[model samples]
Target: MTGMKDVEVVVAHSGRATLRVGDVFLKVDGDPANADIEVQAIGLAPVPTPTVLWREDPVLAIAAVPGRALGALGEPSTASPAAWAAAGAAIRTLHDAPLPPWPGPDLSDIRSKLDRECEWLLANAVLPADVIRLNRDIADAALRPYAPAFIHGDLQIAHVFVEHDEVVGIIDWSGASRGDAMFDVATVTLGHEEHLDDLLVGYGEGADREVIRAWWSLRSLNISRWLIEHGFDPNVRGCEFDVLRARAQER
Candidate 1:
């Protein structure tokens, strides 16, 4: 805890904030439940995770996991295809582990939420109605029930760490829960669709490409409002807006 000469802000918004100090990360979440889930999920995950150094109300201190994030959204990944495949292997390990005790959003709730989000998008003129409609229809395929698996609810590329073409660890477990495994697959590849084949190779074969695409549409539609509300511009190149537009143009 000494030699805290510099503190770098990792992320900050209304919901939560993260700071990096030397080799430790300090996370402050508005909800204590998130902290609890993170601790438990990391403990259960098969992959390497940041060690929990300490915890105080609303603040959790974790030793840094070695290596850099796999990549960032809206940016081309410089990591090798092997690294992407390694990340997929790590995700497969996590999915194979026993499901967390907590339940995730049921299909009914997901459908309801998607409906509400679509309605909001139209009512507020967030996107062209046709764009919304097309993605909405595509997203419908993801709403069907499936066997749940332990999921890293927010498996963005930036949350995965890689070194020497191997996955060292994954960070940000607050969203971990029992959910559709395809959702995790889709999430990890979001805004970085070019890596999908590499990832799937390591994830194993026979995965439903259609379901993964549906999850992409579902995830983009579900998160757009929150991103905009939190001061992020999804319209940035290769981000959510672009993902939706790309899907719309397909077929």
Candidate 2:
């Protein structure tokens, strides 16, 4: 345990807030179902996860896991290649496990959401039209049919923790569901492209390069608007805006 420390606000938005007090973290969700799913995901995941302390109403308390986050958006990761690989290994284990009973958004739902997001982006002139078009094209590849697997649904790299080149824990599993494996992989490597090979080494088969890249674009496109609405900047260096622009320049 990190021992007693003053309360700190880890994150806060209109919808939810996460606060850290001593060695325990408290997450308060706007939607109670999110907290319920988080509890279920922690219990179900095969890989290391934060230990749940208790749940009451909209709040969930969990003991802080050992180690630090692997990385954060808009920041280059200083974590070792082996640490990335260890996170990949954990992901592979999660995906290879039996599918979760709940299903995530289907291809049609995902496409519809992306289309709506793009339309909003274009209407608001939030991003260059060419860049949006290019990313939309890249995102199409991920819409194809594939056998479903248990996915971390929102496997942001920041959720993974590491110490001494080993993944000690992963947190924030509220989005867990039966879904695409590549999506989980892409989410982790979103802004940190250099670590793709290291992650793929541990994930092994089915790490389709093209599909994974497509998910990167798709994820960036989907989250840009939400991030902005939540008072976060998507244009930060190494973030969603740069991700789309970088891919657009390649074509």
Candidate 3:
């Protein structure tokens, strides 16, 4: 770990910090267990993930995955439809893989959390009461039990990298666990709803659109407060607030 000349902060927060030094990424998690989970999850993933360079307590160094992120939230994607499809196919492969040793939150836990989040939203006046109620009703479908699959629990678009219409890699495996596969699909397509058709085409047919939409509501409600607390604006164009508002309009 010499020549640390061009160290750039990738992300920093109370829970974790990530830095880039040359071609390597150094991640420091507040919990050493999270670092351990990341290392193990990367090993279990069926698709390309950053190579672990080394690990020391809370710090883990990983070689950078190639290519840019698929796209950013609140920004238009320049990736071709094929690239999006490739990402969907990659997710399909992950879902089809043997389950990770760790299980994610069960449906009951998810429902309880969703109830708490909805209460928080209403108490804080985060959205119109009617809007929150409508979305909560819509979110119920997603809380039903489904056979768990290996999932990139936080499959945001920015975590999936692509080059030349192919998936180069997926990053941030700290959240990987056995969970509902449609949750991954909903997460990647969040804020990029127009591309859902392309992704589903590659993921194979017969996905439950209602459950996917329910996940959209559930995820949006669940993360909005955390995003605001972390100094990020969920109200930004094309972000969570817009997603909620759009769902309201559909009601």
Candidate 4:
């Protein structure tokens, strides 16, 4: 772990965590109107910033709400349209802001990385061939050039929370990066397109629809390939891959 002298525990994810340090929260800030905030910041607003409450290196941040997150919303339930609408608004707020650097590996260079990962897995006898092939195809498709915009890396309804028929926050900004803004569209349509219309309506302006679509396709392919290359038992980085594959096939 990193030095704890300047950090305190706040929130935790399978891969990362959130912390509160001082006046500046790493992810959560009380400014939705600010264009400088990243799209993922929507969920962070309710929480305090500059404070490392969790003490873990999380990819994203949120307002470590005490007691309950949504109050009446409870856990993620498919019973409310307002819940989804609120999520859409939070996402819209995020999309309106600027993006951080793309830190993960590049799609174009994913082949070599995958090859290494696959070979290692095969050496361990944990590799699958069909899955590997499927991933290769997906990678090829993701490499295509497309417009760049702030993408949540992983945008889905589950990552969002609602308080009262209005979007209160969006969590999990780990995958936050610069890419096709529409990369979240496939997720928006995952279960049903019911909330999608509202999401788009709330997203407002400042997005290149075509570019986002292209990124959406590329992200799906990448996830499929990730699944193929990595064995199941998803509890690792492969979960994102799994979600991408499922979201990709959505009608």
Q: Write model 3 residue lDDT over 201-248, tens digit each, in one string.
A: 789865789999999999999999889899889899999988988887
Q: lDDT of all predictions, in order shown?
A: 0.91, 0.92, 0.90, 0.46
TM-scores for every candidate against the unseen true structure: 0.97, 0.97, 0.96, 0.49
How well is each residue in 65-164 modelled by candidate 4, as lDDT tens digits? 3222322111234536555555555666555565554343455575566556545544554434444344444445445555565556566555554555
Model 2: per-residue Cα lDDT at residue 34 = 91
Model 3's TM-score against the true structure: 0.96
Worst 10 residues of 1 by lDDT: 1-10
For model 4, give the 10-residue run with minimal summed lDDT. 66-75
lDDT: the better of candidates 1 and 4: 1
Local distance difference test, candidate 2: 0.92
Cα RMSD, model 3:
1.7
lDDT score, candidate 4: 0.46
Alpha carbon lDDT of residue 86, candidate 1? 93
Q: Give the worst 10-residue stretch by lDDT in candidate 2.
A: 1-10
- Which runs of model 2 end up more than 4 angstroms from their true locations? 1-4
